[model samples]
Target: MTTANLPDLHDLRERTRQFAQARDWEQFHTPKNLAMALSVEVAELAEHFQWLQTGAATELDDGKRTAIRHELADVLLYLVQLADKMQVDLHAAAVEKMALNAIKYPADTVRGDARKYNEY
Candidate 1:
């Protein structure tokens, strides 16, 4: 779908589910497999920036950018699939995690610092 008509998270998840079901692939989409696939996709995404200078990754050529985009999409798709299989709402989990992170790394104290939360 076009970016202007992009589906919501739930819709996207449902599409992914249906795609897998059509191929009878759900049996291979266990949490473990999905998580591993996510990890591999992330690594593939990282490979595009493996030797780039600090900020160069953001300035990729069209071809590289497209490749990175596909890798990122793959990672996201697997993550959504895994979360669905585990009966977790990815959006809710992310929000809850962010809330905990805010407490662990209070902005006022952590601002401009790169240290771990325990060091703040």
Candidate 2:
């Protein structure tokens, strides 16, 4: 999808920066710390689905869904902070990765296949 279809990531990044600065948290928001926090948030998000048989959208109750949403927000916040500290443009990196992925996994050749790019 085009960036026009995306939310204002730059705005989000600025907001994250302001939030950390206001709290004097920048000293703690090193890329390594942010990465670790991101991992923890991801694990929390995953825990919400740990026991689900299929982990389908329909499988989540309202409370569980709400918890998952908060976990996801935490993950995004950490990622934004991490990108800022690491001097990386998260959206641009994602777009570049998508381009690389297209080269690595051509749709026509990998259609209905579940193998690694190198194996294909």
Candidate 3:
């Protein structure tokens, strides 16, 4: 489907599944490999932020912003691909995890808090 016709998250996930199936990449998309790739992409993203003032980040020029965007997209694409590879429901997993986190860090007790979970 064209970008305009692209579906929402769940639908896109299904499309990702179909794409992987057609390409026969499931066998090579093991969790370990996907995780490694994700880590590498994250490092690439971090490289752009290294030693930069926090406010200076989004101030990137168009070319720099585009480059950073590409790296960010790589990280996201790998994550979605990993979800497809693992046959996991990313949306549900995200919701469930967030719920668990809310319990672990109730806002009344943790609002504006910056401590680790165990500390909280």
Model 3: per-residue lDDT, tens digit, 6-36?
Answer: 5566566666667778999777778899899
Write the candidate numbers in order of decreasing lDDT. 2, 1, 3
Q: In terms of TM-score, which candidate is strongest? A: 2
Whose lDDT is higher: candidate 1's or candidate 2's?
Answer: 2
lDDT of 1 by residue, 20-84 (tens): 99999998998999999989999998898887886375668889988988998998899889999
Ranking by TM-score: 2, 1, 3
Residue pairs with colliding backbones in model 1 are none
State the C-alpha lDDT per candidate.
Answer: 0.87, 0.89, 0.81
Q: Which stretches of candidate 2 lie over 4 Å from their true place?
A: 1-7
Q: What ranges in model 1 sit over 4 Å off?
A: 1-7, 55-58
What root-mean-square deviation over C-alphas does model 2 reach?
4.0
Candidate 3 local Cα displacement, residue 115, angstroms: 0.2
List runs of model 3 lying over 4 Å from the truth: 1-7, 14-27, 55-58
